[model samples]
Target: MPGIDECLLEVMRLPGARGAAVVDWTSGLALGTIGESPNGDHEATAAETAEVARMAAEQPVFAGDAAVAGPGTRTPGAVPPHPPGLPGLAVEDVIITTAPGYHILRFVETSFDSSVFLHLWLDRAEGNLALARMRLGDIAERLVLA
Candidate 1:
């Protein structure tokens, strides 16, 4: 399996892919990053993305949803509540915005419970959103950190 650096490299290979970063959703820290603009700060972006994910996970609507519910009624796969200013959502992947560009955030389902994800920034003009999503999914599956 490829590591985070290799995964980001693959993402950069995608058409219209401008930059990519592997982030820790819990702490909003970047594990690795590539292709970012000189002035474009990825750390802040990762932090903000993490906050969004956190908020989405905590919302009552998302938490109450049956899809997020685990095997039994007692067990829920919902995101835990966070402190103020944090997102309350459980983000699986693919957050796109027309204003800036396509922001793909894919959560890493690892055995260690690291709560990490891939944050990809792509140019809408040259990027195929659907293909990018699919590729990211594939990359996520292949990632294995040493």
Candidate 2:
């Protein structure tokens, strides 16, 4: 599995990648970063993006039927069935499209609290959204945070 730096390097290899970061949404901290930030400040960008991720992960409005199951199927605060080491959060990824670029937040489901995600900034003209998304998913799965 790749570490934060390795994974981020992989992210930057994508066609339109301008910047990338592994952030902890719960704490609004950037665990690791590479390339240029959208705001010229990776830390601020991470914090801002964390707010967006935190909302999507915690809001019941984004929760699907799995989060609202009847009586004994699940415990309070517990997510639904997920991949082997990932959290089964209601939202997987959040993509925000802007006039010049695309911001993609791919949630990383860790074995711990699952508060981290991979943020990618891609040029709108050069990026292939579908390919970036798919590759991000793969990278997130293989990321190893120590």
In model 2, what is the error at residue 76, expressed in angstroms? 12
How many residue pairs collide in each prediction?
13, 0
Instruction: In model 2, state the lDDT of residue 20.
Output: 98
Clashes of 1: 13
lDDT value, residue 26 of candidate 1 = 78
Ten-residue stretch with the least lDDT total in model 2: 78-87
**Which digits, one per residue and each the tens of the lDDT, describe model 1 over residues 18-101?**
998888877888889999732488888888877876665445555433443443543355444433322333445748586657
Instruction: Compute each candidate's TM-score over C-alphas.
Output: 0.77, 0.86
* Superposed model 2: Cα runs more than 4 Å off: 66-86
Report the Cα lDDT for residue 69, model 2.
66
**lDDT (CA) for every model shown?**
0.73, 0.89
Error of 2 at 90 (Å): 2.0
- Which stretches in model 1 have alpha-carbon errors above 4 Å? 37-39, 67-91
Q: Pick the candidate with the highest lDDT.
A: 2
**Can you write out model 2's per-residue Cα lDDT over 13-126, one digit (the tens) per residue?**
999999999999989999999999998999999999999999988885566545456446666766455434344676789999999999999998777767899999999999
